[model samples]
Target chain A: MDLSALGSCVSQVSCVVTQTTSGLISGMLLFLVSCGLTLIFGVLGVVNFAHGSLYMLGAFFAYTVYVPTHSFALAILAGAVGTGLFGIVFERFFISRVYGSDVLMQLLVCYAFVLILDDVVKMVWGASYLSMGMPEAFMVPPLFIAGGVVPPFYLFLIGISALFGLALWLLMARTRFGKVVRAAAQNGDMVAALGIRTPYVFAAVFALGSVMAGAAGALAAPVRSLTAGMGFSVLIESFIVTVIGGMGSIVGALVASILLGLIQSFGAIGFPLFTDGLMFTFMAVVLIVKPTGLFGQRVR
Target chain B: MQAKGTIRHGVSRRAALKGAGALTLASGIGGFPHIAKAAGKVIRVGMNTILSGRVALVGTSSSNAARLVIDKFNAEGGAGGRTIELVVRDSKGRPDEAARVVRDLMDVEGCEIILDSEASSGAFAVHEVMRTRGVLCIHTNSETSQLTADPKMHIPTVFRSARQGIQDAVGGGQYAAAIAKKKKLTRWMTCSPDYVYGRDNTAQFMEYAKIFDPAIRLVEGAWPKLFQPDYTPVITKILQEKPQALYSALWGGDLSAFIDQGNLYGLFHNIDTFAVNLGDYSVLKAVKSLPKGLHSGSRYNRIVPHSAANEAFYTAYTKRFPGQWPTNWSWQNATGAAFMCDALKKTGGKTDGKLLAAAIAGRTIKSPFGVKGTITMRAEDHTIIDYAVAYGITEPVDPYLTDIQMADWGAILEHEAEWKKKKGYA
Candidate 1:
């Protein structure tokens, strides 16, 4: 091969690697948010429309905590715990009442929560964009990988998401509590008949999901602008991820999020204007091809 | 003339006095307006603004500034001894909502004059209502050039106190062109919101920048969705393209977010960032830290005008709000209020829309920041002319701009008439 041809091939390979890295970072962020949505659906049998609001609250909590403490880690912890407690309260007061009701009724209840939480956020934060300064650690020089330089924060995000994913996997698969939760997800009536106290399990799952969303928000606070509308933007993307991955499927969400992220990362470079349209198109094709989604189980 | 002591609308003089007293108490004036009301009757002015949702900061600051001006007027016996009462309606950043609320302000609220501080789309909506209803309207914050530059959209009773997008673009482009020439910066790219204002501003800036420096070449244009929370991909792409300079029209939260994320990728270190909206205090405040020497223009910074009146408004605004910086819209709306008061005084407190509009037209108002000593309300298009067109580098603290470069409006507006004619707007 000619020297120029070899150079071009090397360049192409570098481009692919950079785009893939970009995709992974974005996908991991989406997975962090979507896992919570899917987990809630799996255990509670209710799609929490206010899940995005919980995520937004996490960022705001991080900001509020970060300002006084100046500790990003502490802020993240506070955000997660705060949102988890709020989720518990939300489930107890609102979701618990609408349990075993029609899907539309449950949706309305969650939608009401969405509006309430949105206003609550606006009232607290004011209707302006807020941002967190990047921590000193993430502000270091980018690590050169292959031909492209990667921001250290992106790697930090990826590492944290992977750890969380593993921890969640172990919790759901390895523990006795996990077994009961899984059983409740499959057959809540049967689990209740067996005296499992399914409400507690459901609430626990919802809290866990809310915590994950909060973590995602806290993690993304430095990366994305904190706005009242941030919740809605991420909500739509998470919904797409949950749907594409198969609702209530954690592994499915993980895979779908990465796939969507890769599509977005590449689509942004190839067709910037149609990147959003590309995502919806992918979702439409998935739904048409497999009504149960890629990893979604068929209901008996 | 109607007799003062005689009964009108089935209310006796004594009863009317009692009702007015009850209203004065109910409205919570707290006796401050007692003296002003005794001097003359109140004149109601309605404000249609985006008081809620994402862009509420703009509306809130503008409304606050207008209130400050109105309060000052009321204290000084108001316009021709008529106390000005500002009734505000939230437009919610929607055109249809703006029209509806403006109609309600005019009809139900019994407002004689309207000041709209909405975005361009909402401003156009309110403009239609104002034209149909024959209410004198002063636009405070909308910057779409077509709202005033296009003769077809002109109405006798409508005048824009806000600077036009074309004027900003022309001035900003010239400013950037000079820097690009001097610094040997050639390659250029644009990253603006995917909307009318963004697209038009970017296009106009590039078109005029090339006119100033024909050597400059635009390598790429990225129009991110409006209010897009994440700008990582856009930032990365810009870095990869490696433009010598970039023109960005992103503002508010979006701009702040972009700045935050872009800083991570060292985007500013690589490119000469010429953002039209970076001079805005709201966006500047939102950004965690201002990168030194980021080039921008069009939005107001208190020091850029360097006039006693500008300093006084800035001082009063900051004192009133406490720790809050005055935004571009704050001064624009305050100027609008001042102009309205001046026009009302000229008209002897007559609320006749056309007469007041005529009085304002072709007249120059003494503004703290304007070319040729004052800002003139152009008789032809009813848009304010010769407003200050200055660019400056970003600084760390309050007064965000330094090393200011002022532009001649005559040079900036030289081709406006010809260009409008070419576009068949004349």
Candidate 2:
């Protein structure tokens, strides 16, 4: 090949690599958010409509914590723990009442939570976009990969998400507690008959899911703008991930999130206006082909 | 075929008419006294704005500014001995609610004049209501070019006090073009919200920049979804393209988010950033520590106009609302209220919609932030003209701009008529 041809090939290769890296980072962020949604639905059988709000609250709490302490790590910790506690309270008071009720009742209760949480955020923060300033370490320099300079923050996000994913896997797949949670997800009545406290398991799952959402929010605070309706924006995307990944499967959420991130990153380059429509269309196609989703179990 | 007993029980049409007439007479007498009491006591000005949502700051600040102006007018025994009573209704940033509140303001509250401080979408809906009701409306804070420029949408009774997007775009574009020429930087890109306001503003800026410097070429454009929290993909795309300069129209939280994220990627160090709406105090305060040398145009910086009127208003406003920096909308609403008061004074307190519209048309009124020339309400379009268009580099403090460059209104308005004609809006 001529030098010009070689240059063109090299450029194309670099473009692909950069896009893949971008997709991976985006996917990891989505997984952080969707893992909680799927977990709550898996064990508790309650789709938390306010999952996005919890994510938003996480970011806001991080901002509140970071403002005084100036420590991003502490902010993330406080945000996750604070949101987890809030989830426990919500589950105990509101969600508990609607347990085992009609699906419509469950949806209405969660949707109401979405509205209340959104308003509560507005009341506390006042409706303006806020930023969590980037830490000095993240701003030092960019790392070059495939001729594209990638921000270190992206790598940081990817690393943390991977670590969390592994931790969750170990807790779910290897531990005795994990076995109980998995068994409960399959049959809560059977687990209760086996002398387990099912309500505690449900609350624990809800709180854990909320903590993941809060952590995602705190992590995203530096990368994204913190605004009142940010939860709705992420919520719609999380719902898509949950549906496509089989609603309650963490592993399914992981794969679906990566697929979505790839689609979005490349689709944005190919067709900017149709990026969102493309995702929805993919979801529709998936639902039509496999009614139970890629990783969902069949209902009895 | 009706039963005889039921038919007898039903009142005859004649008796019903007599009873209705008696009730009407009683209502007229009761309402007459209230009408007389309201006649010359107060001039009710109704405001429909987003006061309870994500963009509530815009509405609340605008309303407060209008109230500030109204309070001053009322304190001085009002305009022609009639105190101005401001009634604000929250629109929630929804168009339907904006229309509904506007109707309630006119029909139920009997407001002679209306001030709409909604965003562009809601403003258009409220404008339709104002046209249908024939109520004079002074739009306090919408910046869509089409709202006033589109002849099909324009109503004689409606006028905008805020700066139009196109005007700001043109000024910023020219400023960017000059910098690009001096620095030998031509490759340009845009990252704006994916909506009418964002797309139109970006297009306008690019068009003007190309016009000013024919050597200038657009590398690419990125239209992120409106209020998009994450801007990583867009930032990455810009990096890959390596544009020498970028024009962004993202405002409020979206802009703040982009700036923080872009800072992480060292995007600002590699490129010149010219944002049209970055000079607002609220946006600056929200971000706290913005990268220096980011260029922005046409935000109300108290020092840009440097007039006594502006200084006095700033001093009074800051004192009244401590620690709350006045936003661009605050000044725009204050300007609108001032213009309305001038028109009212000219009309000798006559609140007739058509007459008030006529009184304001082709009239020149001094704004608190005006630079000697004052703003004119163009008779042809009923839009404010000759508002200050200034661009400057961002600084690390409150009111964030330094070394300001002011644009001549004549130059900016030169192509506006032709541009509107090309868009089929004139």
Off by over 4 Å in 2: A1-14, B1-40, B151-154, B420-426
Superposed Cα deviation of residue A194, candidate 1 (Å) = 3.2
Provide a comma-separated list of chain B TM-scores, one per candidate: 0.89, 0.91
Compute the lDDT of residue B93 as modeled in candidate 2: 86
List, residue by residue over A1-300, the lDDT tens digit for candidate 1.
Answer: 123422432367555666677788889988988999999887777878888888998999998999888789998998889999998998888899987788899889888878888778889887777888887777776666776757888888889998888899899999998999999887988999998888888889989999999999998888677877678888899999988999888999999999988877667667778889989999999999997777887732
- B352, model 2: CA deviation in Å? 1.8
lDDT of 2 at B136: 84
In the range B1-426, model 1's lDDT, one tens digit per residue, is 578896657767888899998877754443333233323478888898998888888888989999998998899887666889999889889999999998877666667789998988989888888777667899999889888887778888889999888888788888988999999899999999998888999999999899899999998888899988777767766766789999999988888888888887777987899988999888887787678889978477777678787788788888998867777888789878888988888888877888899889898888876755588888898888777889999987877888989987777778676678778887
Model 1 stretches astray by more than 4 angstroms? A1-11, B1-40
Compare the candidates by lDDT and give the number of the best one: 1
Candidate 2 RMSD computed on C-alpha atoms after optimal superposition onto the true structure:
3.9
lDDT of each: 0.84, 0.82
The whole-model C-alpha lDDT of candidate 2 against the native structure comes to 0.82
The residue pairs in collision within model 1 are: none
Give each prediction's root-mean-square deviation over alpha carbons.
6.1, 3.9
